[model samples]
Target: MHKFIVHGGRPLSGTIKPKGSKNEALQVMCATLLTEAIVTINNIPDITDVHSVMQLLTLLGVQIVPLGKGSYQFCAAHLHTDVTLTEIFRQEYAKVRGSIMLLAPLLVRFKSVSVPKPGGDRIGRRGVHAHFEGLERLGVTFCYNVDEEAWKAKCTTLSGSYILMPEPSVTGTANIVMAASMAKGKTIIYPAACEPHVQQLCHMLVAMGATITGIGSNILTIEGVAHLSGTVHTILPDMLEIGSFIGLAAATKSTLTITDVPINLFTPVWSCFRKLGIRLEEDDNSLHIPFQPSYHIQKEIDGNLLSLSDAVWPGIPADLISIAIITAVHAHGHILIHQKMFESRLFFVDHLIEMGARLILCDPHRVHVVGLGNAYRLRGTRMSSNDIRAGITLLIAALAAEGTSTIANIHQIDRGYEQIDQRLNALGASIERA
Candidate 1:
């Protein structure tokens, strides 16, 4: 257990690079299990959740070698197909929700596998029905064991079929595509998540000899291949991290240059921030957030309160809603933040209110924020980090507050962001992890 002692009132200014996409890295790492050849992955984020997934893969007998910074070589040539729900596997795999994705590749290669119920940030109820439903469409059968308290899936061979997902689930879509890569016949998935990470996974599978179409759309068609050959893939920059940084820069009135950002993927994020009257400059390979006194939250054309909410892909990312809420406190006008996906995500607004920012939690899914603007400064205080997104948001708010603040449960932040305390400290912020 670690806590961050952050001395507020210091503005962060420097060039900092975003780490590899954590969401993309997890799916890409699991893709290694679909092949016998060596799979080399670049720009892998060194975060806790990703490391947990790597440990899970190692337990499944996949050989993984660390080839220096942000690079890994994985080979499932001598993979062990059998997975018993041992205490060790349960303890490790339950720390990362991405561990559930292992079932897809394992079932495709070995026909049967056991997996514990996935565990991760308790932001909301994240059901796995979409994953099981998609798998069943591919000729897979799964059952839960009462005594073992684990899921058991069995299949002799998967014959692809059309799967219309109940929702556009990101991880669920990735799981189905991975399992369908080697299944017989063709698999068509409708209403699939078109998130950037999901698209990245599809591209990687295509490179490994799988035939896939509809790269960036809700409809995906995959023609099963006999087998896949390993290929090298590079992860894009972490967009969530980039959004957090942008919020931090705006909240603290700091000038920051974020290098190597994937600007091509910023249309949705940029549009959302623009609604808050926040502007950023983009270069060929970097994003520049200049120091400004404050931004005025823009109202609707009819002068109604601006509402920012999250939806499926191309929507304001659910992960960034927390940061946006914190950023809203420092802006000039009021904004309504609706976190529709996670019911409990708005509960963290109480801590922001504790810091002297005016916020009303309308419900579990909606929050009404009244910006204090530059005329009033938030008074910092002790707070507990409830989840990954909220932890970083609290950290950003603390940096923009008036006094020192203590943030406990920083491990939540570490699960996604790599060396965040050290990296933020490098940007002239006084954050000590203890």
Candidate 2:
């Protein structure tokens, strides 16, 4: 029940490095269950969701040792086989959707595993059908218990085959790949998610002696191995955090230099933000955004209103849409923010409209923001964060407002960003966590 009290009207300028990807950490940590030897992971983000998944792994008998900051060693030499659907596990599983990933690795090792329905942000209907479908294609059988709301899957021997994912689901792909790693034959996965984090997970599996081809493409071919040994893997930097910082710098007139960023993975992001007139300079490993007088949204050639939307990989990530909308509020022109992936995500704009932002909520999935372009300033007020992305977006908006603001339920933001208040405060932004 913590809150963040922010003092507004200050520009943040400093160098900061994005933490390891939370999504990647979740997937890679689950992969540890696929091996009996020691696996060391580096650059893990110290965030709530990641910690929760680690806790779940520990409960399932994975030995974890802290190697230092952002590093840990895991050994699943002994597993607590009977605790999968225990009451304690069910409670922890409700905290993160990534908990479902443990099922594949556990099944690969134990031949049977049971799990409760997974839970995550109420962004949209995230169906687990893709997970069951892909795994079922590889010779796994599952049965659901309506009374207990649990699913039990068992397969004495997994024989890999071709699996075309119904969608490019990141977690689903990770789950099936982990299972396929221990299967008996060649597995081909088409329409696989090729995000950097997904690629990182695939690379980690390959390091552990799994044969995988098409590391960064929609199609992946995996040859099952008899056994996998432990290997060390480092996660990629969090691209969502980098996108948030870029939007924050643009809206607040700050100069932010983000070091250790993989600038090439953000090709689509740079193009989208450039359309909003927020120029960025990048080097081999870092990116710099200098201070600007005013931001302006670029228009189309035929004079149509510009729009920023989310797509699969290589598009503006859906998680960054909220930040883009907040940046658009301070830019000069008008732009339509279309959140086609999730309906509940764009509903958070009501809080921004309450703070004197000129926005039209066309529907649950679309918003039109009219920038004041420094002609007017938002008056800070109280707001509650609905989700992780929306929470950080509101924090950025409060930092650019004229007065002080209070953001309650900051735990949502804490789930993704590691020590966000402390990190932004290092850049001269005044944020007090209570």
Candidate 3:
């Protein structure tokens, strides 16, 4: 029910650090269920989705202690053996797709676990076939219970084998990898997701005595271990959050510096934004975007329009597509924003068009943004956020608009970004939480 009243037409200048990866935190937190010893994780993001994952773990009998800000200790010494998940979990699972990750770790431990259909942003169809397929290869069987609308899964004798992921899905990769960690033989995952967060999970598992190789590439090999011990792991800075801040600086015409950046993971992002003539300076551990009144979209040397699309990795992340579109609204020249991964992701552009940006919604998956540079300004109005990325993208558009704007249903945003209004407010952006 929370809302953000954003006052527009102001530059946000200051330095901020991106929080720990929300996606990484969810995966690693679930990975904690794979061990009985104490596992301490640093840089846990204080966001709703993470809190939901933590709550799910606690409900499943994981002992969690707050070490301090952005840190926690977990010990899954015992878990409930009942077929039924906690009522609160069933009720809340729809809001947290991360809950689906509990399937593998729980299946490996309890031999059986039941969970309702997972939910998250309504971006598009996110199928669990990949999860069931990869785990099923390792001796897991799943049955759908019609009355409960849940999947009942059991793994009697876990054994590792080669798995070619149906897709490079981050969650699916983590789930199968965790299950494979306890499998009885060598497991080879070809075309695994090699995002920094996925690498973080594999590295964490290795540190905990799981044998893993190919840490940062599409192919990964794991030797099944007897058991995994607890280990301390620090999550990489959230690349999505880092990209959002960069887009904010470009939209608001501010010289902003983002510290604690995992710059190596953002090569494609740098190239994508630099195509818009936005200056992004990188160091060993931070990113800086200098103020620029206007930037032009670099077309193909042969005079073709620039196309920005989402790919698996070393490509512009799909999560950043929303912010990139809004940033493109304020730039010069025209570019095609393609959301090939999710049909619903680009639907939020209607609000930008309502705010006076020139854009063509070619279809559910494609948009053409005619960047007017400084010659144009969006006029803000009331809008409701439908998802995390779209919510933050709307906030950024409002900040660069000509008048105040109200964003409703900001809880979707709260689920992802931690204290975003407060953080952007610190950078001189006028965002009031109500």
lDDT of 1 by residue, 1-434 (tens): 78999999899899999999999999999889999999999999999999899988898888999898999999999876555456888889888898888889889778888887898889889999999999999988999998887888999899889999999999999999998888999999999999999999999999999999998999999999997998989999999999999999999999999999878876788777778878899998899999888799999999999999998888888998998998899999999999999877778888899989888999999999999789888888999977899999999999999999999999999999999989999999999998
Model 1 stretches with alpha carbons more than 4 Å out? none
Ranked by lDDT, the better of candidates 1 and 2 is 2
For residues 272-362, write the lDDT of model 3, one tens digit per residue: 7888779988888888899998898999889999998888887778898898899899999999989898877788888998999999999
lDDT score at residue 165, model 1, on the 0-100 scale: 99
Better of 1 and 3 by lDDT: 1
Backbone clashes in model 2: 0
Output the lDDT of residue 213, model 2.
Answer: 95
List residue ranges in candidate 2 displaced over 4 A. none
True-vs-predicted CA distance for residue 9, candidate 2, Å: 0.8
Q: Candidate 2's residue-wise lDDT over 1-434, tens digit each? A: 89999999999999999999989999999999999999999999999999899999999999999999999999999999888868999999989888989889988888998889887787877789889999999999999999989998999899999998999888899998899988999999989988888899899999999999998998999999999999999998999999999999998999999999887777887887889989899988999999998978999899999988998887778888998999999999999989997878888888899999999999999999999888988889999987899999999999999999999999999999999999999999999998
